[model samples]
Target: MWYLISYVEEALKYIEANYSEAVTIQDLANWLGLERTYLYRLFNSMVGMSPQAYLLDVRIRQACTLLTHSDLTITNIARSVGYEDSLYFSRLFRRKKGQTPSQYRLTHQSPESNS
Candidate 1:
């Protein structure tokens, strides 16, 4: 892979690895062995978003999966998806999906949701 692309990929991998914990640009940059500003620009240039935004997108994606695939409570699900604050998770979930987590789960997944 190209150097910038590889750095971006490493940033993505770090996000996946530590998604359940608090993450920061410094942490991710250190992991990728790049300076924070460089990594930030690299991600934005390649992916159209900063590292933090990308991580939020990933978190929401995992939350969507858990919301549909598991029977966990919303708060627990939030933690599993890496948001420590349940209310903040709910806000982010709603912002991305336009519905509360409970509502999205009921509407998106049914026994027939397999279809």
Candidate 2:
């Protein structure tokens, strides 16, 4: 119980630290010194999603922040968040956020900004 919690915490930290890179469940399990199947089951049981889903969520969340706060091009932003294909990134972003990344940035821009 508590052991699983500790593993989950460590896994989350690793995910956050390496979300910009290409991370996989096997990598995470290897880092934690656990079997991939066990880690996947434990993570899914606790986090309510697969490790891949969690990774995507983290990447998308970071993309949202970069989209709103930085002037980086969408392609660059996508790459920065571990996505190699900007079009796939945009499609995933729209599916998750209900709007294109550009639209999200436009709507979320600061009220005082004139851009």
Which has the greatest lDDT? Answer: 2
Candidate 1: 10-residue stretch with minimal lDDT: 106-115
Q: Which stretches of candidate 2 lie over 4 Å from their true place?
A: 111-115
RMSD of 1: 2.6
Model 2 C-alpha lDDT per residue in residues 70-104, reported as the tens digit of each score:
88889999999998999999999999999999999
lDDT by residue for model 1 (1-115), tens: 4987888887888898888888887999988888999888889999999998889888898988888877889999899988789999999999989999999999877574354
Record all residue pairs in model 2 with backbone atoms less than 3 Å apart, i.e. clashing.
none
RMSD in Å for all candidates: 2.6, 1.8
Candidate 1 lDDT: 0.87
- What TM-score against the true fold does each predicted structure earn? 0.89, 0.90
- In model 1, state the lDDT of residue 20: 81
